[model samples]
Target: MKMNNYYLELFEGRKNIIILPHILPDGDTIGSSIALFYALKKLEKRVYIILNDKLPSNLKFLNANSKIITTEDFEKLSIKPDLIITVDSSDTDRLGDRAYLLDLCSEVLNIDHHSTNTNYGKYNLVNSKAAACGEIIYELLKKLKIYIDKNIATALYVALSTDTGSFKYSNTTPLTLRIAADLIEKGIDFSFINTELYQNKPINKIKLLSDVLNSLELHFDGKLAVIYVTNDMLKKNKIDISDTDGIIEYARDIEGVNIAVLLKEFSDNTIKVSLRSKYDFDVSIIAKKFGGGGHKKAAGCTIYDTIDNAKNILLNTFRENFR
Candidate 1:
């Protein structure tokens, strides 16, 4: 879909802009923000990429120049932003504490690919069918007649490749592949990126995964698999929370398991739940029920309860809905 000309006009008029990515800082959000930062820089616009969380270790390579700033740093800056653009976020709540930026800036542009996006921005560009927000940004850049250089292509490639699980996930489409091909043509070292993303696992992360796998349990006649990660597990292994990325997939990939869940104890009363499913089941529906949202096969929600209580709540939710 072509980007609306009004958005282009907003960009042309807005000189001081802030780019906000969703909390937890996934590849798609980081990549789309970086790609847009470079594109806007070429236009001579003062662009700032403000993030609520630190970039994951594997994704740090994409921010080698340190263009992305922490919220604390943004607070120190006196420059008033003319516009704020949120990328890969479904709703304002996904911005965490930074959601205040929406109220501060009169001109807000929200770009995202999630089907559950709330269209919260004054100007929203949401395409639920797009494989990733990177695809939409790529199209938007083309529509704006912006030149996509190697840096921009590399960022967009990271967004496309990671969100689609390196094109292994069901969300991968022909256009996704074609865009990847175009990115490769721009001279991105995809091999290095793949190695950094998948092959280069820290020992602490591997140890944490071992502990997490040992907590795995099967339910619903082996159709559901569940795993747990406690703060103790993370502290024992000296692992960061971000190191737990992709660990839930181990449960989801098991044979006969239609649904996989990862219940993470973020705090004494906060359980961060990650849900993945196979076949026709829509996990996003379940996530939305809990005030979170994501794609059909993958989704997440935060339960304000003990780990055991969260598990029971999820099990009951599944029994009530899927049965």
Candidate 2:
């Protein structure tokens, strides 16, 4: 959907703006937020990027000189935002504790590409057809007549590339590539981004991956694959939960597997479940059933049960719905 002219008008006299990314900061959220930050800076708007979690180690390169603050930092500041803009977040729930900002700010502009978005903003520009939120931001910047310099281009490139799985995911479209090509033309280093995003894995991450692979299990005659990552595995390998980002892809890539599940044990009973589908399956359906939501092929939810119980619940759900 095209952005309403009224939404653009929100920025007309707005001076203090806060950009909120999802709870667990990902490349798409971070990249889109930073790109907007640079663009708003050029407009002489005082903008702040506040994140609920720390930036993943691999994505720190994108925030080299950017001033991204934490929730604690925001709490200490006396500034009340004139407008709140959320990027790549489906709903206020995805904002974690920062959701209260929606009530505090009278004006909100929610920009996202998730089909399951709740339209929780005062002015929402939700386009499920867009491959990434970066695409929406790029269009918004163009409409505002903002210049896309190398910094903004690099940020947007990372946003589009990561959400599209380096342009290999099924979501990639002609417009996606066209925007990416434009960003590349701005002199962004695509090769360096590829290296940092895909190739620069730390030793601990490698060890964690090896350990997680040993827990992989196949069900439904290899049509479905499941992997487990417990707190013990993370402690043993000295890796953070963020390191498990791309591990589920390994399970999804299995030859006969149509669906892949990653059950991460955050505690004794809190299991974070990530689901990925390779074909026509819509994993977001299952995620929404469990109070979470995402894209058709990729989604996640937290199950308040033991690892074994969570796996059984997912397996039963799949059998009831998919079998």
Instruction: Tell me the lDDT of model 1 at 46.
Output: 93
Task: List candidate 2 segments past 4 Å from native.
Answer: 64-66
Q: What is the C-alpha lDDT of each candidate?
A: 0.89, 0.89
- Model 1 alpha-carbon drift over 4 Å, by segment: none
TM values, all candidates: 0.97, 0.97
Question: lDDT by residue for model 2 over 1-323, one digit each (tens)?
Answer: 87767767878998999999887677898899999999999999999998757677778788633578876788799788999999888878789788887776878989999999999888889999999999999999998889999999999998999899999999999999999999999999999998999999889989988988999999998999999999999999887786678889999999999999999997789888999999999999999988889999999888899999999999999997655
Clash pairs (backbone) in predicted model 1 = none
TM-score of 2: 0.97
Each model's RMSD to truth, in Å? 1.3, 1.3
Error in Å for residue 40 of model 1: 0.8
Q: How far is 317's C-alpha from truth in model 1 (Å)? A: 0.4
